[model samples]
Each structure stands twice: as structure tokens, then as C-alpha cells.
Target: MDHVILFEGIPMSKSMRGMCKEEDYAFLGEKGKHHKETDTLGEDWKEEKMERERRRRERAQQEQERIRELEESRKEKEQQWRHHVSELASTQEQRLRDRLARIHHFRDFQRKVLVEEMSLQTDSESSQALDQLLTRI
Candidate 1:
């Protein structure tokens, strides 16, 4: 006898005859076009994708906000530095003007004193010459 055999009503290939039992023969119905039905997961998959996109957008927005805050802080610091520099320059200019005014005043006073001393010396010399001429006569 052969190692594989089929029953009278069961229609199966000779190769699969050894793998199936006599009881499995009753389960096989009429065979026609055997198309496998795939499952639909539209709602579940769509919600998952949307959730991931939302998280990504939130992270990007947070990063942009952090950069904006840093820029604002930098601008504020720069403005403060500019104000400090202008104040310092104005104060230094005022001090320089005060020093120049004092120097001018002192120079004018020295000139007046020198002119008065020269006039006094010339008057004394003329008086001495007249006194010498009278003695000789």
C-alpha cells in the first residue's frame, strides 16, 4: 500500500494526503476563489499620526519661544550699556569745560599784573634823571 491515501469523497492533492487526517476531510467545503480579507484600522491609525504631529509642533513652538526670549534679553542689555556710556561721556565733557574756564581766568589776571609793574618802573627812572641834573647845575 502507498504511504499516503485519500478518501472517496475528499478531493485533495496526493502530497497533502499524509498531513491531514480522516476527520479533517469533513471541514473542507467547496473551494472557489480564496481571497484573504484584510482588516481596516483607519480611525486608530489616523488618531495616532495626528497625536504625533501635534507633539512635534508643540516642541518646535517651545524652541522658538526660547530663542525669542533670549533675543529680547540681549537687546535689553545692549540698551542699558549704551545709556551708561552716554552718561559717562557727558559727565567727562562737563568736567573738561570747567577746567578750561578756570585756566582762562588765571591767565587774564597774570597779564594785568605784569602791565602795572612795567608802568611803575618807567615813572621812577624819569624822576631820578631830573634830580641828577639839578645837582650838577
Candidate 2:
């Protein structure tokens, strides 16, 4: 680069020497110009393009992973809720059965007491009638 010459204050090609010949160049500092990959300014544009593309692909992959995690979490919560609802239903059913059993027991006890009271009343009325009959005789 330091050995490059200038023609009329315009930057020119390198001098014909060990690395190149005068017939090998078409313009100053240029090979036969049909867009070679090596002649980009500052940095290689292909590498930059590839880097941006890679970043886009990585972001897409990460987004898919996040969606999958959210889906799994939603399913897990739904399953837990279903189990909780089942437990509540079972508990309600048990309570209803117990209440019905208590009502049946109370009805049986009431019927037995009523039967005993009726029997005692019948015996007392018979004794009173017999005493009156004996006194008259």
C-alpha cells in the first residue's frame, strides 16, 4: 500500500514489481473489475450479513422455546385444577350421605318411643274399668 503511486493527484495502482504486472490491473488499486468478494470497504459485508442472519435465527429459536414452556405450564395448571374439583365433589357427596343416615336414625328412635307410650295407656284404661265393675257388684 505504501508503494502505490499517484497519477495527477489521483490515487493510482501499485508499481509493476514482484507482486503484480502492469497488464494484470484494469484501474488504479483494482483488479479486472467485475466485483470480487475481497474489495469491500472497512469490513467484509458478507460476514456482517451472515452475523445478522445468525442473530435472527437464534431469536426465532428462543421464541419457540419460550412458547413451549408456557404451554407446558398451562397444561400443568389445568390438570391440578381438575384434581381439586374432583376432590371437592367427593367431599360433598360424603357429607350428603352422612346427613341422610342421621335423619334415618332419628326417625327410627321416634317411632319406638311412640309405640311404648301407646302400650302403657292401654293397660291403665283396662285396670280402671275392672275396678269400677268390682265395686258395683
> What TM-score would each prediction reach against the true structure?
0.45, 0.54
Query: What is the Cα-based lDDT of residue 85 in candidate 2?
Result: 97
C-alpha lDDT score of every prediction, in listed order: 0.64, 0.65
The residue pairs in collision within model 1 are none
lDDT of 2 by residue, 19-56 (tens): 56433443655533434644573257777888999999
Which candidate should be chosen as best, given TM-score against the real structure? Answer: 2
Residue by residue across 1-137, what tens digits does model 1's lDDT show? Answer: 11123344567687787787765654333221121221235666678899999999999999999999999999999999999999999999999999899977865565445446544344656446544533353
Residue 133 miss distance in model 1 (angstroms): 36
